[model samples]
Target: MSTTDTSNSPITNRRRGTLQLWSRTLIPTLREAPAEASTPSHRLMLRAGCIRQVGAGVYDFLPLGMRVLQKVSQIVREEMDAAGASEMLMPAIVPIELYAGTKRDVDYGDLLFKLTDRHGRDAALGPTHEETVTEMAKGSVTSYKQLPLNVYQIQTKFRDEFRPRAGLLRGREFLMKDAYSFHTTVEGDGGLNETYDRMYQAYVNVFTRCGLDFTVVEAEAGPIGGSASHEFMVNAETGEDTILVCPETGYAANVEKCEIGDRDWSFDTDATTDLTKKHTPGMPGIDLVAEHLGVKPEGMLKTIVFAKIGGDKRKYVLATVRGDHDVNEGKVRDVVGFPIALADEKEAKEAGFAIGYVSPRMAATRDDTLLVIDPDATGGVWATGSDEKDHHVTGFIWARDLGADLPTKDQQGGKIRVADVRNAGEGDPSPRLPGAKLVARRGIEVGHIFKLGTKYAQAFDFTVLNEQQKKTTVIMGCYGIGVSRTIAASIEQRHDEWGIIWPVPIAPYHVVITVMDPKNDEQSKLADKLATELVEAGADVLIDDRNERPGVKFKDADLIGLPVRLTIGDKALAENCVEFKLRSEDGKGRLVDIADAVKETLSKLA
Candidate 1:
């Protein structure tokens, strides 16, 4: 594929010329949003005539939406090229065999949109291009001389979302700018880290240029297994993911990967008494049981049984945390080093374990079972299950009742293990700043960069001969930005009740020449002259020459969300001045001399 170098390109100089409203363009504004639209971006896009739903989780971008999308793609392309990356296109439909090498076909599960061709061959839409890119690298590049190569593509992707909603935020079919970097080794300068850093900065530039209020936080790699990854999230109240931030320490992370910093834990062994079992009638939940036992929920141990499956082996693992806390399945998976599922009641019963009343004593009794205990649960005297129906154990000390072989200072020893396996709660210690507390906020993920060492390279055997003439697998880094979603995210971050307030860099047109009535020769002449001068001044201009009321034209101008609006009416034009207003600012339009209109618009755009 051929690549374009856009480093010297100007943002305001669009390839297309000036647009004329009512005749040359379409802006089908709606008074109310469609019922399916939920988020502000979704509702606004529908009302502004930027997009229309073709099916569930599928949308057709109208001219206005396409313009915004193209602008975003161009910015991404320029940034990638500036970072010394090449552009290439990959097929949207990939053969199923390509994914077989990486086992992503199974890993992606139902999310993979699989299909059967007429010749009875298996095919699937590309949800991601890691495997395909690695396969391509294997055939084309053969030595370290071709190392440190970064290639990117802006293309459509497909995923079979279980419940696709929130319009472009979680669409089934969407546009994405995905880049992959290959390196001969991960260590030293000018290696994987260098390329990864460049991509990271490129992503930062992309979001910032789009005028998004976003943050970079440590994130879980998920299906894209990697040593490290960071997600770029646009901050918003209605975002789906929770972001943990420590103000004092400048530490931030997604909840999935966030860690609680150091804190002191003191166990009141002086107030503890002998362990005793009491008869309880029913299987009440933790809150009810805490009330029954006259103890706080934190003074109880909540034991959960999980069945870990790897290859052909399935082992039942018991996980214990404070009753007030919840288990983080991802952390447990990491500890067990395998995929896990909640143990069914039947399976627990068949394994000689009580469904809800299982105790830590079972871990001591069975050598085959694995045990994981949260760090908070290690030094506390607490209420616990007695391993019998209708019975509870009170004052159960971790050291005494559980055989007292517990390792001091929070380390795995004997059969019991102590780790930070529960989800970090609000007010937990900040990992980066001592004595600082972690706070939670919501954000929408717009981009992700992963350090995907040799996972894909080894799968596809993408190797190169090093300087020493040794065959070495290529290390990789994958970075992605949702091109269309970035547009929606911008709206999510920068919109008011009136409409979207677009940023100057990516706005469809830098200025909108709103002529009240094109039939009026004075207004038409002024609007046409202003547009010509603005285009010459390095601004994309849109002339609203429609024969409509001033009120309707003004309303449409706001809805369409051009960065600047120049209103040319008989009143303003007769005064030898036109009203100029910025869409992002409040209040009435200010009158500027018609002779100075182009100069004023150019300055505002700058």
Candidate 2:
């Protein structure tokens, strides 16, 4: 069997650019995924030989993975260009000083991969280029005419994740497409708002083209300090984040930012009883205390103490929620109107708090302490800490025990502040629609867009001249898309027991030509002819011409998951036809005339 040695031929090289032969490729598919590959996408990527882990939270993209990445990146590039964002590159090593000026260095904390340069100066790998890009604008963009300029880069980012799991979904080192836009105003034409909308649409187009079932939800701009933000989440069963959606009004938000509607939070006057101390030895958690008292968690108050981040150490806020509900620290921060951290047990103890047995009434023991209770926690007869070791207060009623401290209505100005400072959950009423409850869905966030306002502009001194010839700080916006994570997310959303069913647009190759007998001249000639035709028809073709059995070739084709597959065998060709299959479809596929191979493949791809 003399196969043509065209590995270096000019025509072969040209075809190799988009048409790959299985014999010349480097796919090392594993029969079984490793135990450490926890997620479906992680397991499949490993078994399909798309990536190999090099270190914790880091992986090397194999050839197949690189092709998928290139295709996804190209889609991003085209959409960004169409949205008027100019592509630019920034250095990966950023000086620590840039972040120090914005105080984000402290915000990033250990997440920044800090290093000492040769000159003894501090530097770090760029996690995001907001500071660098803002500094650049401060130096060059000083005129109103240069306003509303958006520049972006497709680059690698590093974050020191405490635990990077789920493959590329949450990696310490990964590829990202981050874009920054500078504007003179916020809402007018060619301003930050306009540019933000354009970028949002571009993201929609990009993800849509990549074939993701996603939802755009209101989100909190954590650490980035933006006024407004939204996250594009790809729906997945094994996603890390919980998304709450309102079926009636189409309002959706991540659990961290979702709001709860009005509930019947009136105090249960009939259930009120004298607050009496009861023994609850060794019961530190709400669940433990509730279990000890033979009461439901919903009828208990869970008080958590927090100290202001930059305020007096002795001063604390007692954040209380229903035992069944969890306090949202973000909502607590907003109610407190400052940054706060969970109070250290030692410091809390020193401040007259019982620590484990601390209760809402602990606010009365210290002049500096404030009580903030979630509305749901303010109504029911509750079991709470007794301000002493190994004791709890049973029959705790808000109106009777707390008295004047408990607000008459849900407001912040009272002695006992009441607010919706708890995380929303499934069946919780939607804040936007009356009588409609919030639904839950798991999602993987793929893109985020933020209206940054002037947070970075002010920090970096980025300003521009207004029409009045006066200097004004530029309004800025930040947008990010997880370039590599999208691949894993796509697999998470589209994979089956057989293998990944890659989307047509982002598949490593659009079609795989499986030759049942590569050594046979008839089968080999048919594969070459069909591959050339498909390549000319603008489809990436991978010819399975390796000396493998028919079953092996078919399995490999399904495992790699090209969008379309064409099988050429002596039996099929003897009937002047070939097997046409779609990887996304079930069954072995129907026979088609050999002459119609290219046309049918292109139709399936389209």
Candidate 3:
């Protein structure tokens, strides 16, 4: 958790000199990686001997690979500390009892990597440690004085992903820095909100200092069940994610919660014409049906099938958005006022609703009926399902002739109904900033932070007595950084055909000192001088002292892409100089005297 212990670690000094430029520690380079590696990041990372596949979505990190991992972790640690967070270690193998109390053991279910111990008790490789951390706090801390406690750990997490690819970017087993904060209230004054904003600011600094070009976007808390969450994404062409962004205002968020521009349509209860049925053969879909009827997209109706909780089978919801527009499921959920999943076709058939032929009039007219009409779906006379095969009802009014009132089927008294249940598309407007419409970008998640509220604390009874001595659950927030994925992400952001271009702060070695044809005393001597000087100048240097050909050494040098390279060759000796190469340079190197070259390259790295 702290660097003080690193000084005494076995490999800190003992193995530093043993690593050879071409022979050991790492494979140096592989001529070819497997064809399965689609992106440069996956190929280079494998060819560089940083990682190897152990399972479909799991990896084994080699020594040099772990050294870079530590450097990345150290940066995260410093940033978390700067934000006044305390560091702790949590076990990778966690007991299921902790999650049982949170009632999320089943929530995780198949996504959890569960195994039984010798004693035959269920345990899991922690995907994140909210349950463990809150349980630990519950057993020890109780006073309100300890109301705000922040703890974090850099640990390996596991998930049972259905499909895994893109190397470490979405692996089943990977490294994560997850932190959870406990508070006493939900208000921004002093509780979960203060910590949430603090965590957000801390995340900004963490990604910034890591040399990562990242953006924080609004996201769902997902199975973790939190009120709000944000995802840190690195923009890259090879990225696996697609985010909707506003190019005009720099507004961005995941597709799930993206907001759109304004378009309103509402009709009084007495507006629509008489409900008349008409033939609409071969009109299985809304688009085809609208075209068959000589109607614009906005002049038609669309119904979706969804299974609500406590329902016997999937039911039809005749949500009438403008024909040109799409449905936002979140709005439908807001109408139902709870979490629900869409009902598939089989369930719809069992509910006696024709798969393709469904109408507002045909659906069961009861309090339990879900009929949510969009603002535009209400006032307009439109064409919709006739509930019979190859037929439709036109000039159908939702509120006026249909006796519907504002997304409710309770006859204006009993229960709210469900209307639309489809996902919104790219044309939607900005929910946050005005004049900003949704734009698109590919993103890969690098980090995430969530306001957990009292979910974990209340589960474990992790509480503190308020001023009046009333027992109250502590509010919570959780933060995470994809440590292993950062390596793959960095390569995704900074790489070319040659090899990886790492940012300075996390590069394994600052400089590579190549003694081309080291058998020559002159070249060896000059290389040694440069290596020593650069090391003393506070640079981590890799010295190529092997008796290899000049071509081999040069090839390896460029292939590894150390930020700076120094060559002490016969040509340099003749000029009383050394060839100075900046690996990222666009042109040939310059010759400087051996002594001056060391300081010169060091300056470039600085």
Best by lDDT: 2
lDDT of 3 by residue, 458-547 (tens): 777677898789988788888999999987898889876777777766777767788877677877776666666666556777787777
lDDT, candidate 2, at 188: 83
Candidate 1's clash total is: 0
TM-scores for all predictions: 0.90, 0.94, 0.83
lDDT on C-alpha atoms for all candidate structures: 0.84, 0.88, 0.73
Q: What overall lDDT, based on C-alpha atoms, would model 3 receive against the true structure? A: 0.73
- Report RMSD for candidate 1: 4.3
RMSD of each: 4.3, 4.0, 5.4
Candidate 2 residue runs with Cα over 4 Å from true position: 1-17, 221-227, 272-274, 309-314, 364-366, 410-412
Ranked candidates (lDDT, high to low): 2, 1, 3
| Candidate with the greatest TM-score versus the true structure | 2
| lDDT (C-alpha) at residue 591 in model 2 | 95
Q: Which of 1 and 2 is ahead in TM-score? A: 2
Ranked by TM-score from best down, the candidates are 2, 1, 3
- CA displacement after TM-score superposition, residue 154 of candidate 2 (Å): 0.3
Kindly indicate the candidate among 1 and 2 with the higher lDDT.
2
